[model samples]
Target: MTTKEEIINRLNLQPHPEGGYFHQSYASAETTGDKQLFTSIYFLIESGNISHFHRLTSDELWYYHGGDAITIHMIHPDGRYEVVKLGMNLEQGEVPQFLVPARTIFASTVEDAAWSFVGCMVAPGFTFDDFELFKAEELLPLYPKHEAVIRRYAL
Candidate 1:
């Protein structure tokens, strides 16, 4: 089995602000106005670690690569909550790919496994200006019913 350190070193990934390790794999030269058409990154997260709740301006598509499955927790603008599993087991409702709509608050974790490897692509590309990480205090009032998740995943 590939270790998390090995994967991180092989991919030259750096620690991401939201947790996990990542390396930008692609950035299109073509532009849609000032923003790039798309951008991609190799992302990995270990069990017990989490990608904290964050929102982006563009939609993101995640593709599972290896290691263990990951559960993505999403909190939509209208207070709807959902969990999306990313893995190879289709029979168990695990999908190899999942799409996260733009502006949704989301987070992820690799449960019951050592680590998980995945790739993420963003349309209109991704920019630091368009990313926002949330704190528990900031989200608690808005999503009072999801207090547990908000507290667990928020920065």
Candidate 2:
């Protein structure tokens, strides 16, 4: 029964609130993070730490924590994404963050080292009861096979 403020204070993470899932990392006590109701963060690939592509709710948000570059694959109604890439021009000490909306399917890459980030589900908050994961099985398989990734999200 730890309060969000208490948890934030205990973790010593600032309100980085980047507005995007690629904003920051919440776990591992390594980077700035956000407060989520039911959403959870994950360290996808090791060499790249990429969180696969998947769908999301209309109120989901994400922030970037660490890494060199990330590639986001948006699932179109036609069963494919536009391959939107983010966080590629990030340099040392010049990190930036962006906010994300729901119904967005995306992914990130670390390449040289392990990268991580945090996320949040707004409105009713994220929960396993309201959580879903897209594994490309239900999606239209017509994109780069390696990019059709799926991750956990709250709707």
Candidate 3:
């Protein structure tokens, strides 16, 4: 089995601000307005690490590749909370792909394995300007019912 360090080194992934390792893998040359049509990356999360709560201006599509299952916790703008499991076990109710709409605050963690490897593609291409990391205290009050999960995933 490949170690997390090996995967990171092999993929030339950098430390993602949200608490994972990632390397941009693709960027379309075609532009839609001022932004690229799409962008993709290789993302990995180790067992003890969590992807912090954040929101993006563009919609993101997550694809599960290998390793452990991942649980994505999303809090929609309407104040609804949803948990999506990303894995290959269809019979066990794991989904292989999921779409997160623009401006949704979300986070992820590896489950049932030492690490997880996945891919994330964004329409309108991702930019630092489009990313917003959440502060637990500030976000908690907004989603009082999801306070526990917000506390667990927020950096």
Candidate 4:
């Protein structure tokens, strides 16, 4: 079996802005006039590290590849909190793929596993300008009901 370090080195993954290790794997040459159609990346988060709360201007679709399961926590614009499990076990209620709508605050962490390897695809591509990281202090008051989670995951 391949190790996490091997995969990280092979993919040239670097510390992502949101707290995981990631490297872009694809970027469509085709564009919708100006913007690229989509882009994809290999994302990995080890046990104990969480993907901090952040949002993107474009929709992001997550695809589970291997390793362990991850729990994606999302806080919608309307203040609804949702959890999505990404894994291969159908009987265990894990979904192989899930979509996170644009502008929704989201974070993730490996659940009871050594690590998690997944793919993230963003529509209309992705740019540093399109990413927004949340500060715990700023989000706490706004979503007080989710204080515990926000504090735990926010950067």
TM-score of 2: 0.46
Is 1 or 4 the stronger prediction by TM-score?
1
The 0-to-1 C-alpha lDDT of every candidate, in the order given, reads 0.94, 0.40, 0.92, 0.92
What shift in Å separates residue 6 of candidate 3 from its native position after superposition? 2.0
Q: Cα RMSD (Å) per model?
A: 0.9, 10.5, 1.2, 1.1
Best by lDDT: 1
lDDT of each residue in 15-109, candidate 2, tens digit only: 32111222223323222224243333422233322444444554554444434344444555444545533453555333344444565554444
Give one digit per residue, the lDDT tens place, for model 1 in 1-155. Answer: 77888989988999999999999999999999899999999999987678999999999999999998889999998899999999999999999999999999999998775689999999999999999999999999899999999999998
lDDT of 4 by residue, 1-155 (tens): 98889999999999987887999999999897567899999999987776999989899999999898988999999999999999999899999999999999999997565799999999989888889999999899989999999989998
How many clashes in candidate 3? 0
Residue 57 miss distance in model 4 (angstroms): 1.1
Write one digit per residue (lDDT tens) for candidate 3, span 39-116: 999999976777999999999999998888899999999999999999999999999999999999999998654688
Alpha-carbon TM-score of each model against the true structure: 0.97, 0.46, 0.96, 0.96
| Residue 140 miss distance in model 4 (angstroms) | 0.9
Minimum summed lDDT over a 10-residue window in model 3 is located at 108-117
